[model samples]
Target chain A: MNLSLTLTINGEQREIVLDDPRVTLLDLLRERLHLTGAKKGCDRGQCGACTILVDGQRINSCLALAISYDGSAITTIEGLAENGALHPVQQAFIDHDGFQCGFCTPGQIMSAVGLIAEAQADGDAERIREAMSGNICRCGAYQGITEAVLDAQAKISTGKERDAA
Target chain B: MNRFEYVRPTSIAEAVAAAGEPGSAYLGAGTNLLDLMKGGVTQPSRLVDLTHLPDLGQIEQLPDGSTRIGALVKNAALAHDPAFAEAFPAVAEALLSGASAQLRNAATVGGNLMQRTRCAYFTDPASACNKRAPGSGCDAIGGENRAHAVLGWSDHCIAVHPSDFCVALTALGAIVEIEGPAGRREVAMTDFYLLPGDTPEKETVLDAGEMIVAVRLPAEAAAFAGNQRYLKGRERTSYAFALASAAAALKIENGLIVEARLALGGVATKPWRVQAAEAVLAGAAPGKEAFEKAAEVAFAEAKPSGDNAYKIALGKRVLARALMMAAAGTPERMPALPASPFAPLPEGVVNV
Candidate 1:
């Protein structure tokens, strides 16, 4: 039973024919589309290594079936750059050294982007830390991650302010 | 995960009809369902995807002042909704407290209500869990169960329902709207979850082919908006399930409690609501004395099912502390750590 679906992934429209209904969104991105930036640390939902954006909201892609997300716009780690320039969050992570092993960096950056867009972090360090609790960095890079999120949020908000002005 | 037929229903009637199949299951967000499926705990023949259905993704304020939250509404969306947060602060706090931001963004309200136990025995296919395989046996009773249920647990099963949102909803007297083969009906949140009696597999009051359409919070439940809190005690500061938790709401008039609602989580098979404890708090001054008495009444029938005797004592303290926080009044803004015990107490509020 082949189920056909279309996904706007990383600003590209990709048509997919899924032969298995059990294929998760993470597997589809990493295996079929070769979007290996989104790592699969834990196939279970407990780990946020497979976090991605579906219609601008952050979700654990490992637990989401590909067939269930038909026609939805998805954004992964590969989508975070513009014109080969790093996204603010990605730049901020590099500036603050937000990772060590880097296995969880892609998910961390994607989740940070989603968090900043949600605007619930309010540029507060504690709020950012709480919000990013889902994306675990086993290397204990949370201090840098939190700092990076705060910095990126400030940069984004200032950019918005500049745009409005 | 086992392969299954995926059915996307455009209408509630269609979804219900498709779910009427012998081995069909209603799939909402698939946060819990897919996880359980991958773990080999449950294998359904077909999944009726309910995310496509219209009108189940809205949060509506009815003319009668009650709020109707769609079953498909995401947890984060509902919690961040200013009107909902202002009206049902405790519920919002509870929602924010459970899981991480990513999970909250994908997990639906109905999925949260329908989530199974976090019991290791239940999730592991090798273990003999009565809740997972009915009449098989319960390994949790004699296993490592420091996190097991302490109230309303039977010999058949001792797994606690792991939802902080349900804790607050049980206290607010939320009503679950259901669509089933027989037609539409409503069940109070307090009665929606069933205790693990002899039929441990039957977790909720929902029958076969029934789907949760929406959950309604009556207008009266908003009365405690000013003085309500959901406090969770966990091993970690964040992103962990509760060791024990309590939701406390009070309506104070002339320095006396007119009505109080209290419920416990992580300590029972269901969100444990003790009306007798509320009766103890009624007309009493919102003080440490009254709160302590209420906590005692709340845990009157609680007994540890395993090595969880500490949960009963911890649960009582959580209830008392939550009552104190509620008496201190809801915060002007949500705490940085929404429901964590480490969140700074409101001014003039002392520790329990």
Candidate 2:
């Protein structure tokens, strides 16, 4: 049976039709919408290569069914940057050399952004490491990745305070 | 993955009715179900999505001071919830230590409880797994059985349940509330999981259409929450399945143990609760000797395979350590040890 779903992707409403009910959000984004920022490493939940933000919560999109999130808001890595400026997390990743092969970069950055949004990436290095453990970089760049997440968290928190002021 | 029909029901009655249909599976977070579907292990003709049910994602305190956690409440939210953490710290810690933050964000409490074992044989469609395909022989029995169960495992199946949250819930004496086409009912957490006896395919006592509504923590368990601890020993520091884990809670008065609740995971086919061990700790002082005695009684019935015999000793040590730690009120001090004796040593490393 063909299913039609309407999802708010990157703050914009997008409607899509699926011929197979087993299509995952990761497949819908990469194959249908051509939003290939989310990579499919294992096609299973074990690898965090398909991490995305669903209603501001970090989840593995490869395991999430597209139809289950019909009316939810999704934020992929492509949606992080706005107005021709890189998001703080993206810039922090580049500045800290958080990646080597860059295959897991998008997922790492998206998870980092969601962590900050969830207020889970506190200033503690151990906390940031544990939170970012979902996204694995085979290049062994975890030290740099942990550093980038902490740096981006500080930037995000400061920006929020400034906006409030 | 199979092409299945998906229906999102707006009400519990409709959801339960749809689930009662032939070859229908309830989809909570789809973390475990989707993975199994991708592995070609499970093929459901229909998926009844429970996410759309109203008021199924809430976490509230009942009038009896017990907490009622909805079936759809995400694992990450339960771990970070201030009230839940305050009432049951070990439950929060166990949830946090199970999966990554990303998976936990999508996984729900009900789904976590219903997750299947991570046995390689069960996941591989070609392997002979009695749990996956009835009448088939178990590959883990004669194959690589390093991760097989050491307790409550039948010859038909040696797989262990891969849930850390259930172990803690069993120790805390939680109750699982279920809703179905028949009526509403409650099942004790200890009875929620089933041993892998001759009927390894039948995991839980729930009927086909029965759905878990919420998990209730009794108000009496609150008194021992501060002294509870969930300790998991894995191959790595994080993101790995437990090798031998323990969930322990001690009620100590005047430096003597008045009551104790102990359950084990990662080494049993189900959440292994040992009342004999608890009986041993009833009037004894909280120390290493008492903990050792209790651990001995807990593992007196353990039957391990050839490759997994090390788990027998490891499970004992883990349970003893968890009991002592819970009694000492130091749950966060999980000390790291060197490589296991069973593991191959490094090239240049010398063993004493």
Candidate 3:
């Protein structure tokens, strides 16, 4: 059975047709829409390569079925940059070398962005670190990723910019 | 993943009715169920997405001074709740120490409780895992079982229950308030997850149609909480499966061990409670010797495999040290040494 889902992606309102109940939002974005910034490392939820934001909270899009999320506003790595400008979290990652091969960078940056926003709203470093723990880098670049989160917090605190493939 | 009918039920009755079907499943937080589906492990005929059901998404206080946590309450929210932190701090610590923050944010309490094994063999379709395919046989029994259970494992399975939150909750005397197709009933934390005896397929005793509505934990257990600690031993420092873990909750009255609760994870198929050990130290004065003896009692029934024999000793050492650290609470006490995941499993890889 097919389900029609209307939602926002990168600030644009779009409607998606879920051909199968098993097709996830991440699958819909990468396979159908061809927005492949979110990599599928494990397909399972163990890896955080498919992290995205729905209403400003980080969720593993692989586990979120497309039809279930029927009218909610969604955001992916493709949505982080607007009008040729990058989100502070993405920029901080670039500056801090948060990723190496960068396969997991988009998901990492997305998780960091959500975490930093929560931190700004009175979340402590421990809380931020605890929250961002799901996103893993096989390159063992956690030190850099955490530093970039702090850096992003600093830049977002002031006003600065940084993104690219 | 197999094609299934989907229904985003907005109310509990609708959701329950949808899940009441023969092969219907409740997708709470969709953490484990979806993962299993993609791997072709579980292919339910229908998925009743319960995220939209408002009835199962609340956290409130009961008249008995206990807290009722909705099944849909995200792990992150439950971990950070003021009442959870203050009342069931061990549970809070367990939740925090569980999957990283992002996972906890999206993972619901019910989902976390129902998460499947992280065993590589189980996830790998070709591998022989009895839990995944009953009567297929357990490869971990004689294979690479460094991460497998060291206690309460039968011949059929040795896989461990992966939640750190359940370990502490087991010790805190938490209860599961559930609603099945028939009616609503409550289960204590101890009886929730079953050990892998002859039937590895039977994980929980709950009826198939029964869905967990809320988890109610005694608010008083938080009062007994003092210097709670959750120590995990993993291959890597962060975001890896546990080799062995210890959860300690101790109370110091009159400079002695008035009450204590200890549970082990990653080393057992169930959240193992050492009540005998607790009974040993119930009135005994706090000291290294008493703690060591009590720790030994906890591991008394440890039947280890080839790769985890040292875990018997390692669990005792860490449990003793963690209990000591928890009891002392002052800076004068020295921290326990990190345990090693060094033991190797036996030679033959058994497949039923």
Q: Give the best candidate by TM-score.
A: 1
**Model 2 chain B worst lDDT window (10 residues):** B333-342
Local lDDT at B343 for model 1: 90
lDDT of 1 by residue, A1-165 (tens): 999999999888989998899999999998999999988998887778999999999999999999999999999988889999999999999999999999999989999999999987796888988999898889999999999989989999999999999
The per-candidate TM-score of the B chain, in the order shown, comes to 0.99, 0.93, 0.90
A-chain TM-score of every model: 0.98, 0.97, 0.89
Off by over 4 Å in 2: B330-352
Using DockQ as the measure, what is the rank order of every candidate, best first? 1, 2, 3
The interface RMSD for candidate 3 is: 4.0
Segments in model 1 whose C-alpha atoms lie over 4 Å from true places: none
Clashing residue pairs, candidate 1? none
What lDDT tens digits, residue by residue, belong to model 1 across residues B20-125? 9998988999998998999999999999999989999999999999999999999999999999999999999999999999999999999999999999999999
DockQ of all predictions against the true structure, Cα-based = 0.93, 0.62, 0.48
Clashes of each: 0, 0, 4
Ranking by lDDT: 1, 2, 3
Flag clash pairs in model 3. A131-B101, B180-B210, B307-B344, B307-B345
CAPRI class of candidate 3:
acceptable
The i-RMS of candidate 2 is 2.9
Model 3's DockQ? 0.48
